[model samples]
Target: MKALVTVMPKAGVLDPQGKAIGHALSSLGFAGVADVRAGKVIELELAETDPAKAKAAAEEMARKLLANTVIESFRVEVV
Candidate 1:
């Protein structure tokens, strides 16, 4: 089984790295960029094949180590 984990900042949190990237893009001649936010995508291969089990385990992983629940939110997709 393959799992994709996406971790993103909470709506109200400020993303400095994202802001920096936006500024860099504008400097390089990209226009009309209003805002930018950054997030992380993690791909994992799992031995489990059942979708329910994979989803449960992925959620656990996100809660335990993959994401910070206080400042970030995550979604898990199994393929």
Candidate 2:
């Protein structure tokens, strides 16, 4: 099974990196860009074949180590 994990900062948290990216894009003349936020994607291959199992496992992984529970939120997708 394949799992995709997306981790992003929670709302209201200051994102310096994302702000920097937005500034860079504007300087590069990317047009009317209002806001930009940056996040990370993680791809994993699991031995579990069932979609439910894969999703559950990935969720655990995110809860435990993949995401910082306080500042970041994570979404798990099974493929």
Model 1, stretches more than 4 Å misplaced?
none
TM-score of each: 0.96, 0.96
Question: What would the per-residue lDDT of candidate 2 be over residues 1-79, giving only the tens digit for each residue?
Answer: 9999999999988888999999999899897888777889999999999999899999999999999989999999988
Q: In model 2, where is the ten-residue run with the lowest total lDDT?
A: 31-40
Task: Give candidate 1's root-mean-square deviation (CA, Å).
Answer: 0.7
lDDT of 2 at 7: 97
Summing lDDT over every window of 10 consecutive residues in candidate 1, give the lowest-scoring window. Answer: 51-60
| Residue pairs with backbone atoms closer than 3 Å in model 2 (clashes) | none
Candidate 2 Cα errors over 4 Å, as ranges? none
**Steric clash pairs (candidate 1):** none
User: TM-score of predicted model 1?
Assistant: 0.96
Query: CA lDDT of 5 in candidate 1?
Result: 89
Q: Global CA lDDT of candidate 1, please?
A: 0.93
lDDT for every model?
0.93, 0.93
